[model samples]
Target: MSVVDVSGATTSRVAPFLQGLAREPIVWLIVLIFAVGALTSEYYLTALNLENLMRNVAVIGLLSLGMTVVLLTGRIDLSVAALMIFAVVVGVIVMTEIGPMLGGRWLVRGNTYAGPIIPVILVALATGTMVGAVNGIGIAYFKVPSFIMTLVSLTALRGFNYVLTNGHPYYLKAPLYGWIGDSKVAGIPVSFLIFLLVLLGLIAFVNGTVRGGRFYAIGGNEKAALYAGIKAQRYVVLAYVISGFCAAVAGIVFTARLKSVDAPLAAGYELTAIAIAVIGGTALAGGVGSPWRTLLGSVAFAAGLNLLAIWGIGNWYQNLAIGIVLIASVGLSRTSRKKTHS
Candidate 1:
């Protein structure tokens, strides 16, 4: 009787844990990939490589967080990469113009500003927010499909970025501007730390708040959410605004890290963001995902790319691998949804 009781207690505790793990197999997949990498490469498990990998994925990870939210709402934003480029370009230009008026030197061989960091950051974030508002308005008020609306924004914004810079890259001369990307806090990159904070905040918002639950409700069943008296359009618009703000933040960090911004910077990143979110186990049909899983997906993506680089794979093959992974993820999501419904 004692043995049976002990066995029953163990089963009761472990069954739910196993079921949770089964529900998110991607987590296990990530673990497996890391194990393989550690075993295969002498440098893969080193602290330096790990840090570099985190830094490399931080921007995409930020974008993925926003993408996850949008996906949760049964929508998508294809203009995030272009918005990032536009924000960086506009921010840098505004800072350059303001720095001279503020009595700062024209540093870096006459092409960069030495001050106005705060104002520039604000301008960039505001620009992204405004663009997001437009996207939201068009979709919510005008009843436009999110895919088409953002697709048009993507094209127009990319063109605007090119027109603003005339196809040339803008370099920031201020060390302070680059510090966010270059500096470390307690042996961790500042950019990664920022990413970590954003991730945590978003997790709190989505999992711990009623407002976040509404987003899921809307995505899961729009008619039901509307019947429940939730303002579906407002929440959808808010999601886009959040996505735009995130893209702007990513742009600033990316520019600081690279010390330069180009009109074409982060091209194709929207697709990559979507891929990361979907691969993280977010349902493409919407209403099922977590930011924590998206973070793991981003890390897995960065790791795969790093491994490819180490093995001397070309960019084309990298893209191919990403496509395959995306297809598989979407298929799995669809299957899971069907099973749940059945």
Candidate 2:
């Protein structure tokens, strides 16, 4: 081949490949992080640690799934962690109150009720949905900025959680709840499996459903979506509802795993979830990103934490490491967007 022909062909093949890498830089970042972990620690690549990592990331991963959808619509849900806590609190309270009515006794073994698990799960989900609906209505119809709306909800819901629990944690002795939170299937944790199922469901909804695209449209340009006959408000509201539902599910799973529910159960998890979503290449500006990316982000975050622990890092340094990761992820996201647009 002529020199010019060879050069042109190489450019043609390599340019698209480079572009693809730029579009999803987090994938490379995750690979790099994993490589570093594997090189630095003998235990990092062990199956037990990997399983523990998956179990650890499950709640945050589930929260990030909902947050990704909300961010896709150019909104935020600061109340998600609080909502999760509140949902679990409500579920525990209901179980405590209703166990006797259902001819079930409070199990002294774990200081938990031996009540029907279904009712507790339903109530937790419903609580999250209702709270989410209120957040949606305020932001979508009332024209409240999502940041402020969800901030208000964060405070209110957290207060409610405290009030509901009387500043104490409730132990759940229900075997079924424990199973949902702690059990394993085919060598995988149930919580992780639930997170994976939610991740898949979200991926399908966002990529395959009309309503899912509507969220992107609304985030991409609300005024334009509205002009195009899309009920932008409703979809925005739906996004919050989804977030709330995810929070509720996370709450239940977390409670089951810990075998207890506390007022501050998931405090500050909202920030971690947001960081995961943003790190996963989900655009903070909206109209871009996917569940798959968020999943990668969640895994990366978990891996980083595991590495820190293995290195004998203290909790203080661990948090600092997360902050650094968050900043780096945001910088990478901005750089990628610039490259794509330019």
Candidate 3:
């Protein structure tokens, strides 16, 4: 074969590989980070640390899932972390104040309510959904901007967290909570297991259902979707409701893991959650992204944090690192969009 023919063949072979990498930039980034982390520290790649990392990041993973859903609808939710704190606190307060009235006993010889754990979960989820509904109503019905509405919710929910807890923390000793938060199955953390189950459900919802498709359609072009008879406004509200429910789920996981509820718990988690979603290749402009991508993003983010801690990095530097990653991801997303359009 001539030299020109060989060059063409080589290009044909490499082009597909390059395109694959482009399609999953987050996966490559994850591999790179993992390689660096493993090389940098002997402890970074250990099983114990990896397990703890998964467990600890589960709350953020849940939040990121919710953020992904909202972002898919071409909107932002800034209240997830605050809502998380508020929801768990509300759950704790209810179980404490009302458990006795309903003949619920303290199960673990401490503050843990042996009363139906189901009610506590329900109450927390209800609180989150209520707040999310308010946000959705304001944005979808009153034509309020999503950012502003969620921002208001963020403030209110944070205040409610403090008020409900009276600026204190409650330590829970519930058996089921401990099992969900800390127990392991075949050496894997239960919290991480919960996160994985949620991820699977979300994947099916977004990829397998008509309603899920509507979310993407609405996000892609609200006016166009409306014209297509998609009921864009109602879907927007549904997106916020899902976001709220996810936050509440995260709160439940949080309380279980720590066996405690506090006003300040998960403070600033919203920023990290958004960062994770974007890093997973979810476009901030909407109409693009997936739960699978967000899953990769969450793993990458948690790995980064684990590496930073292994290196004895300070908290301030960690925040700086997250900021840098977020900006880079956003830039990459924009570039990819431009390339696609081109």
Choose the strongest candidate by TM-score: 1
In order of TM-score, best first, we have 1, 3, 2
lDDT of 1 by residue, 1-342 (tens): 334588889999999987986777677776777788888888887888888888878899989888999999998899999998898788877777766687875445645555657777899999988888889889988999999999999999999999988887877766677788888889898999989998999999988999998889988999999999999989988888888988999998898898888898898899889999998888988899989889988988888888787667999999899889888888988998999999
Displacement of residue 224 (Cα, Å) in model 3 is 0.8
Candidate 3: list runs displaced more than 4 Å.
1-23, 103-116
Q: What are the clashing pairs of model 2?
A: 112-173
Compare candidates 1 and 2 on TM-score and give the better one. Answer: 1
lDDT scores of the candidates, listed in order: 0.86, 0.86, 0.86
Residue range 12-128, candidate 3, lDDT tens digits: 999998797677767787898889988988887788898888986788999999999999999999999999988877877777778678776543455445555677889999988
CA RMSD for every model?
Answer: 4.5, 6.1, 6.5
Greater-TM-score candidate between 1 and 3 = 1
- TM-scores for all predictions: 0.91, 0.89, 0.89
Worst ten in a row by lDDT for model 3: 106-115
- lDDT at 229, model 3: 90
lDDT of 2 by residue, 1-342 (tens): 635688889999999987986776666767887899899988887888888898878999989988999999999999999999898788767777777787777545554556667888999999999999999999999999999999999999989988877787778767788898768999899999999998889889998899899988987888899999999888988999999999999988888888888887777789899899998888888888888889988988888888889989998898787788778877877787789889
lDDT of 3: 0.86
